[model samples]
Target chain A: MKLIGENLNIMSKKYGAALKAKEAKPLQELAIEQAKAGMDYVDLNIGPASKTGVDLMTWLVPVIEEVVDIPLALDTSNVKAIEAGLKACKKHRPLINSIMVRPERMEALLPLAAQYDAEFVGLLWGPEGMPRDENERGALCAELVFKATGEFGIKPERIFVDPIQTPVNVQQIQIMSVLEFMKMFADIAPGCRSTIGLSNVSNGPPDHLRPILNQVMLIILKRHGMYSAIVDTYDTMLHEIARDKHPGLEALVHKVEDGEAVDMTHLSDEERSFVKTAKVIMGQALYSDSWLEI
Target chain B: MTFQPSKQVYSGKIREVTLGSGDKAVTIGGRGVYAFHSFEGAMPNAPRIAMEVWDKDPSEDWAAAAKAPFGDVLADPAAWASKCVKEYGAEIIVVQTKSADPNGDNRAAADVAATVKKVVDSVDVPVIVWGVANHEKDTEVMKLVAESCAGKKVALSPVEEGDYKQIGAASLGYNQLVVASSPIDINLAKQLNILLGNLGVKAENLLIDPTTGGLGYGLEYTYSVMERAGQAALTQEDEKLQQPMIANVANETWKCKESNLSTEDAPELGDAAQRGILMEAVTAVDLMLAGADVVVMRHPEAIKLVRNYIAKMM
Candidate 1:
């Protein structure tokens, strides 16, 4: 899996302080750690960044670039800020974090992406907002992708289609819808790649329980052909699974994903946890705080 | 879009590994494309064929067609290697240390090293010393051979998961290259490469042997594994699995019972010599298509045929 580190966000207490203070050291340190953690890209999620978006991104891109060689995913709602970040990405192709299926976002960002020759994620969330199901996601993908490729002249290879990930606790059905969209992504876009905000699946779950949901969701998404993911830099277990180091665990997850009759008694503690977590994500079992114990 | 072909966009490349030192050193791998998909990306180095030279005379074991070209040189490995380079236009020579097998003559490590050194000395091209895959014997023989042939950049083959530590360390110490052998499984192949990398063997000093199987004998399995390895290296950006692959095609192809079956015994099988040559050539070509950087082949005819195929493809 091509990992895009999701740690360099303004939401992080430590890094958010650094971002607010315009301190390069903490952000650069996180960037280096993420690169060393085997991340293919580092997502600089300056969420919405409406106020100082442009200047902050301009400063931030160069700061991270000073330390690590990885491409930075310029993530923000502010179009001007994305352009500032893209301008600093002279070494590699920077990714414009998202171009929502909505016209306003597409019109603002698509030209910037074309002008900079940058890769951008085609966020499936249309003007109607969060897609109802796989069909809606597919329709949004078609609209955004056709415009990006057909009108804006973006190559299909440069587009990364993100079938938006919803928290498992709230929208368990949407998680399955995302998987269904993944199965259809290649057929829809053909050459375009796919990525996800992997941590979103575990967002509302308890901190202790989050990693399992995220990891199991990753294995399932991978089977459905996820090209890359925006993931935590410190998630070593997730990284190992992505690198295919744990074949037995991957095999067990595949069994669960395949809906095979797996006897819970035959599994070890770790294996049982993964199986149960996968069940919750697949909506085979209902979500609860103490799901693992159950 | 009028039925456009889906082209892969690769983020990683196979590391190019140069074998031998100075003048005749040959480099393989370093491709940003799948096999020979030259239209999409660069295949910097064309696949090379390393002609096989046995450490011991193979009059009894080798098929008649395979032994026909060497003639008098078959008795001496150095002479055989020289013949391969000078007469056959072989760019590389692989000295097969079959006699050192614990099951066979069980030649001492020192004895095999001496013979391998002679072969390395005789050939201007790169020399790859292939061990008999017995973990203990390979470890012993390759350690001495790496030490004896220091600075030659000779490649030590059949370095399995069990023996990578000893052989890998030897390669590291002597600056030799290692051909990490694995079963016909992409996961095993990547695991062995990872193990070698952990032993401080640089990517440029490594080669992957996904264990070749001749035509009609698990060739499809070998092909698929190699295809997957190439896919991972180029598309998935799997750095550990991106070392150029070397298929030990000669041993597997020639040793098959069909290669030895006489025309009189099996009239419908056509000429024995031509059949063996075709099998070897077909297997070599198939492997090259599946992303083999180097194919260790025995017959000159087969090598020439494969060279032609590569010429056309490249």
Candidate 2:
């Protein structure tokens, strides 16, 4: 029942410059604040805007590390940026944002993950694209796991598979497919972890809709063995689930995740009492158990 | 000297397309009667339904009626799907890779593969692998997806104008089916079919998807195109366009603000949930009648209504 908290850090090239100019101090401080606020990892993303070939991680990671000791999830589309961050990372074993199923990318990144002895996120689709059905998709997942464990020599426990999230506007069935797949991964590959980016599905809609959808999707993903996700570190909905304080809190969390105004008035005293009771039980059963270890 | 009257025969939307050698073959649904009536005249085995799943989360804008069944399970895919199969009766599950959207998680290929595998393991029903409409990402992810699902016979698709080669080759290599999508234009639909054919993906292995629009958002356009495409398959007998059809009903219906919003916001509106269900149901049935082999939808109530309508019609 102990809630395992993965650091939820949002690191960006935008924040890095802000830190240098002193104007960005708040952004870095914000990330540090998230870590202080109970995030297990602060995600560092040096987006495309950053100068290429320069190792920002070598400099920035230390600064963040100086302020907080939490683990980091090195997130980047650029291989160089990831390497820079990894090189400067203070934590002994940080989580790699991802290594996709593409042969070239996997070949390049898997070794890095192995060399660092880091936990890695493995996407299901490779160079071809997402398949249309579960059987083929499952086969694809098996192949990735095989490569991660057999070829990369990484342990299953260290590998987290991200069943890529598709947009609801286009491929509607994919939403259910992802949740089913998450469950399948958990059942089939118990040693490995499952996770996803929490904000991808509601990409095109009104801004308010995103969080509610995310919360609902997260709960589905969590039930299906998704142990972690790359989400806004400060999201209350996420905190509710991670804390396991209220099982029904998912309804409210989903509303918030979707950007809907949460009306606590809907809950009766009985429901409110249930949430309080659940929170106490969850804290005692899940969180309190791990306090001593931490 | 008495004369007997013939009964009005109705057909379902499920169709089965058989390809390859005995037992080592693939069977995909194309059950709508209008598609290829000359062959079997349409009894059962109409097109299947693909349920929706998202990469991030489904928004609250979803009609309360649609969201009600999902309840607590709405948050998790595995739990939701299990309910769909066990409770709601989903025949085939389609996992849309929406997270692959470039603006979103822009998740890598391995993530797509993992998710596909997870759903495959969750149920006995077949699963569909879908891309998030990013041609570049689809090309990148599907190859790994095809390779990962090798010999499993999953359907990978919506292989549109610019990126058919990558998806086609991957599907062909994996021995899975490909969904060839085109705008509502019948000629364009046929052209895409021909393009898929040229790629060496057989007609039987192809599922034709003429893009769908929801109620009030040009459903008539979709209906006309689908009907024309179906008529072409039946009367004109165009082999290229004769393949099964897949229509996404839930995506379009849910997008209609009328279906998801509260009636209180619009007093003229009837029951919003019922309206949403009706929109999806009507769209699904209309597509089926128009010759859709597969009707992918969201709301369970809508699915039930469609199923019952198909039952009554057949």
Best by the lDDT measure: 1
What's the lDDT for candidate 1?
0.89
lDDT of each: 0.89, 0.66
Candidate 1, residue B8: Cα displacement in angstroms equals 2.1
Please report, as a value between 0 and 1, the fraction of native contacts recovered by candidate 2.
0.00
lDDT of 2 by residue, B28-100 (tens): 5554455434344644454456676543356554667877878777666666666777887777777777767
True contacts kept of each: 0.00, 0.00
TM-score of each: 0.56, 0.47
Off by over 4 Å in 1: A1-294, B1-3
For model 2 the TM-score comes to 0.47
Docking class of 1: incorrect
Tens digits of per-residue lDDT for model 1, A88-200? 78778999999899999999999999998999998888888999999999999999889999998999989999998998866777998998888888888989998899999
| Cα error of candidate 2 at position A209, Å | 49
Measured by DockQ, the strongest candidate is 1
